[model samples]
Target: MKIDDVVKDTLGRWAEEATVPQGLADRALRRRRRSRVRAFAVMAGATATVVATALTVPALVQPSGGEAGVILAEGKPADDPAISLTGPPEVSADPDATPPTKLVATEKTAMYAYYTWDNEKISDTRQILKQTWYLYNPDSATYEKTPWAAVDVAAGGHVAVLEEAQARRVGLLGPEGQVRWIDLEQPASQLKWSPDGRKLLLVSYAANPNEQGVFDEDGSSREIVPVTRTGFSVVDVAAGQAFFRPLPAGGDAWGRSVDLHWSDDGTLIWDWDTGSESSPPPRRFYDLEGRPHAAPPDPADTGQEAGLSPTGRFSAIHSPDRSAIAAVRDTSSGAITPLKPVAGHWIEQAIAWSGDDHLITWACELKGSAGCEVSEFRNRLLLVSVDGRQAVPLTGFRQNSQKPGSWEPLFARR
Candidate 1:
């Protein structure tokens, strides 16, 4: 699995107590990681792999150092659901490619990591999904591969957050692939790095959120769901000290996929609770002590994640109109401003804002109303102006955009 599936699982898993494919277990639960990961892992020097890209940055291609960034698979594949690895399309620009092989980002924001996956059916009622990840190397301007069941790039794109499977510890992975191990009383299913890059937020769980099981009416199948969330920990990055907080889930079974993210100002962490039937619920904040906090500074009336800009002045959202495309709301005046269309058919999804004027968004080549829907949208990452007049492709459009396992990007500040 790629370092990013090491993460895509978090998109959906990270580390797990639940059942995963045999191949995944063999890969994630390795002798080296299971044993050696405890001690301070020596920061072995690494060499960057040369990759072809459309970006104009001066490229530096270095020879591979005997196994700097790569981890070798110890054993053969276990027979259950066979694995087939596919590559993401070509990188940035050239609308012909999808999922993008070469992703480009601005000085303020970068595509730190992305994941692509495939699902294979193991039985009539059961299917196993596997993911491959690509980690972006700022020094080489290329995406490198690594093994992480689930991973999260830190705010600055300099570190990766991951936990050992079945173990009560978390790792802060640095640029050279060196890991700083911090012991935990409980295992975290996922980890979040704050925007200021000073702390690590570990969200604990009882199982791998990616794997679920179903049964027949007569109760013929076994349950695959693990225990709901136990609580969380707020650990200082430099100090390596964790403050444990217990917020146990009662009968309500909420898996780790209801993953927690930090608020814009980095003062709080939150999860969007989908109580029973409501979708796109507002931001539910929690303080460092796990106490329920206040509502978001800005309302996600349009149901956009991270819609509010960093400064909390404007809120970005998809155009309310099917034809108007991307728009931003003036937080002070409550006025919505629609952006001008580029290429006669341009529509922007202003998701990750770089500053007050620009955003890192998705560019869809598909035209018309169908383009607005997820299944029909063939997307690429792009740096765009709030007015929609200028745009730069951060990645090539994605392939198989309709599938749930398709490539998804992890944005980070450079």
Candidate 2:
């Protein structure tokens, strides 16, 4: 069949090879509501190929293992440095509004936990820093929080705050909530602990933009300083000292931010700019030392919305076709797996790396002219394993068009 015909047929109606079990829609919807903060929190700060690199570490963290690791990025690579807040400021809220702090189940046992906290902005210029942290284990499910902070536990059963300021000194709190650790520094942006719970990945902004002014919803000119480059650091959780990886030098990606995901073996993976005006354009992978390793062959074909599989050995890039998903095997010789085209209509949304080596996606409504007539406004979730199988439809939902979203399980059900 012609590609256009396939796309049209798949998009018009909710076409799926997989059956949607009873209550699957309700289950999927419930999961979406429960995981809202976790999913959008980190993803909000992710940037296009030309924006800032911010870290939105998940609150619930699972330790990944094995020799080599997988690398992936999430969503359409748009350069949006603006910050959005869902809840009110952390200050002066009805005590009842706060949910009990606790650990929660993420997709994979070794999956990355993403959560957000809204704190009051003491300074008018600073938006309440909605700090994002990654947590693990019992802590992920039953974790609790004090004012302005969240606690995370690791697999080894060791507990720590996913806050950068907390690293300076930690202490037991008294019955009155007085902190003995007395963290004096401002909180960092995206702060997370390593699998060992012995290290921290804290993302700090290199420059704070001056807020010129606030504007109404209309397109009025508000004098605001645009947030520029954001830098990252790896701190020894115990030592409190951190090593820094500044933005790539003289590259357009300096401000065009990207998301960060660690492989099972602890390799840092990100989507970044590799081509210069004199060179071809492509998004490539770099090591911790800021060195390039895997550069895509065709710069234009190098799309974004990348995610690292749970196993850490493979990565899937979301593009127009399944062939856009790139899988990498980190071995002595190192290997690059190209994307394979999956059959059926799919959306340009975030991709999740499942524990069982399968891929899941949220297929969006394809326009009639785009060649897909499945539905003028219908959306569905697709499940396709990494083995190049036909895409299977799991569930369908009325297309929101705006704010349409879905989730991928990092681990297969145990």
Instruction: List TM-score per model, in order.
Output: 0.67, 0.42
Tell me how far the alpha carbon of residue 399 in candidate 2 is from the true structure, in angstroms, after superposition: 7.5
Candidate 2 Cα RMSD after full superposition onto the native fold (Å) = 15.7
Give the range where candidate 1 is weakest over 10 consecutive residues by summed lDDT.
Answer: 37-46
The per-model lDDT (C-alpha) reads 0.52, 0.35
Candidate 1, residues 9-58, lDDT tens digits: the string is 88564345563221232233222121111111111111133112101111
As a TM-score, model 2 comes out at 0.42
What's the lDDT of the predicted structure labeled candidate 1?
Answer: 0.52
lDDT of 2 by residue, 30-145 (tens): 32232222222221111121111212212121113221111112322111111112222211111111121222122332222233444444454444334443322231232222
Clashes of each: 17, 58
